[model samples]
Target: MSKLSLAELVSMVSETKSEGILRPTTSKDTGRYERTGLAEVVNMQITSGQFIGSRVPEPTYLPPHWSAHIHPEGQLYFCRQGSPRVVTEAYLYRPETLDKVTGWIKRIEKLIADQDFPVSAELELFIKLEDEDCAYYLTISAFLPSFRFRSSTCFARNCIGTMSNFFPMHGSLSRGTLDSLVCVFMHAICDQMTSRVSTFPYSKQDCEAFVSLLKNSRDHLSDGNIVCTVARLWGIICRNRYLTQYGQENSRLSRDQAVLWDPETKNRWVSTVASRISFRTSDRYLAQLDDVFVDHLVYSDQWKSMVTGCLRDWRGASHGAFLALMLHIFLLALTPCPSLAVASASLFVASLLASTLLLNRYVPLQGVTAEQAMDYLEAVQSPTFKFQFVALVFALPHTLNLWGTLVLFANCIFMLATNFGTGFAAGISTVALLAFIAFQWTTSDRFNLSLARTHDKFRAMFFRNPDASYTSEV
Candidate 1:
């Protein structure tokens, strides 16, 4: 088929309209234009020697600087201005009728022409044409862009208002379509920022690889993968913004150091990043940044497994602590103990209470998914006081569980001494001590407490400085 230009399509559409072969319809509320009789117009054009096929060429069906591709599954994806990186949502299927195709072209042209409509820096527009009678336009802005669904009928228009319903839109759109849209959005935003800024830490190849992973493996990816992907992109954007706003001299500075350099930059950066991520509170924004940086540096599966393992260990400890606390309480009620026994029981009770409270407050009791685990890990690694406090609280359940266990052991020894004789109690205590030492030696790693090795590994993972070193007493 021969390629048709935008001018030719416009001329043909206008002629058809004049001859009454196509009737234009306008919505009073949204001022959106629609037309009917596209099939008749197409037949007339072909019969009169204007075209050769049942459908016009695909090139003629799109606006200027746009091209269309059909996926293996028949979904239509539009690329803007011949750039592979700039793509619209893959929601529309291949149009069966010329009317549907031409209708899309008109809507896209009008959307781009409207100066007030928020288009991306790359001139990317997401248009969803539904049932030949309604269309929805979505554009990326500083914040979560609202979905503007305009319909020919007032009932349809009123049913889906101008509300910012992003998650709800997901229900209507397929998973693969959403994934493609997100990948395209990230690439476009990163492309725009990289072109304008000079201090991006990640190379172009890095960003491309990330987007490729999301686009290629979207079907197999879990929700955590998508979240981490977005977080990684956000980190790059934040770092670029930081370097742009506060000179590149601060590029070497860690997040803490950079924030300290200009306290005001923190607020400004938070607001800017907030707009990009659609978060409002400073705490949530900072929390998300922690997530972004951690996800940027670590593999999703590796970190997810790490956090999941830690969560499992904590749950086990919590369960053990609960059982120990109950047994200790039962023993205390049964036996008339000395002052030492009472004090030890009280200490155990207090520790267990604090641990239980923290566990219930901070940890999820149900199955901990990778996304939830990542959130916990981020809070643990966050530098902010609020997050650090919450992390400490989360750790308390495990840490205090050990303390409560020791207290319970001491109370048990006291009960043995009060009920039996000193000789019997001493023998039992000696046996218990030996068993604990043997268990530690046999099951735990011998070099687990080597701080120097730990420091070296951490530096290798996080710090790229060649001069970085760690020293410990021999």
Candidate 2:
């Protein structure tokens, strides 16, 4: 049986904007492409009959070699590799076809570097049979995602890299990607969906819709694009939610006039939409679920990073407030438990160090000027920053008082009263260890429960069965 080379397949995939990863199963051992470093090993995806939607379908994993690395250069792909015939939007090359691959590689390199910002490309590949033996092939098509910059410096919103560390805090918030992190996030969340709607290689209607949206004004001042931006944002949010919840993938394009405007325009539109409501009325509605909204926003990476950056300032304030209390406690213990002085001091010192480290390392609060310190606190204290604020409060009492006070209290009660110094010390140590274990168990269990519930609710809200008749609420 004759097999196609990696260069041949990639050439076909890149030019067509096909969707799917490529993989090579060679009859002979293939060596690396010396010039381009394209894997001699062929590993990619193919789009063909029945897989015609813009959203890519998850494919069979060809172990050992198949991965996203094949298409490092920007291009699209669509190929079906199971049979003798392969259809790719990319130009096909034969084994030892170096020039074609080289030409395409240079073109992709230019596109990647020429962009003022970053881009995430969507590719599709399909495989079909010309004859019963699969002697001939048919079509491969590629579609590239539209990219735009949001006014905010929100890092890696829809990128793949962000998914590992964060979850979406807002409903239907789709990020505009311009970097690797955003790509990674999309790859993990959006890219993994199974399309239930239409096939790839858009129908005339899909193409027309995309073109119409593309032609619309990019400026926020224009009202024409507002609906499209809102739809696009909702589509992104809904699409991702659908994918994560029910593993279904559908082309995000909708027949509705909305869902295709510039990203920046969309952000402005959302604020404008929210602003239509009077503050008196809006504030009342917001106040009812304000805690929920604040919790989601503050617990997100946006708030996490903000609080973490200001940890030093928080530490200084915390220490200043609690240091006197600690010193007073130490003085009081000294008279009642003279023999346990060293233990008490050790506990107090450890407590302070732990508190300082928790603030500085986790949500640091130390060393800022009074103004910056106060400003930082105010920001954290804001309703928009509620989750971090809650976390900070929960942490304070434990770090400042409980750990040290409990330890010192035990030392005084056990060692001084019973005079069973060594035995009591060992018992306290054992109990502390057990307490730590219990803390870990409870914390992990609670987090797991909360996560499970959140996922269930998110799924129920957005991803009812395709057969289930429903309409968009807003």
| Model 2 CA deviation exceeding 4 Å by range | 1-239, 246-336, 363-400, 406-474
lDDT of 2 by residue, 341-444 (tens): 45545555654665565564544333333334435544544443332333434344234444456545665556444555667667767887799887777677
Judge candidate 2 against the unseen true structure and give its global Cα lDDT, from 0 to 1.
Answer: 0.36
Scanning candidate 1 in windows of ten residues, the lowest lDDT window is 164-173
lDDT of 1 by residue, 292-334 (tens): 3332232233334334554565566557766765776567675
Off by over 4 Å in 1: 1-104, 107-126, 130-249, 252-302, 305-309, 315-334, 338-385, 399-403, 406-474
> In terms of TM-score, how similar is model 2 to the real structure?
0.27
Scored against the true structure, residue 296 in model 2 reaches a CA lDDT of 22
RMSD of each: 17.0, 23.9
**With candidate 1 superimposed using the best TM-score fit, by how many Å does residue 439's alpha carbon deviate from the native?**
18
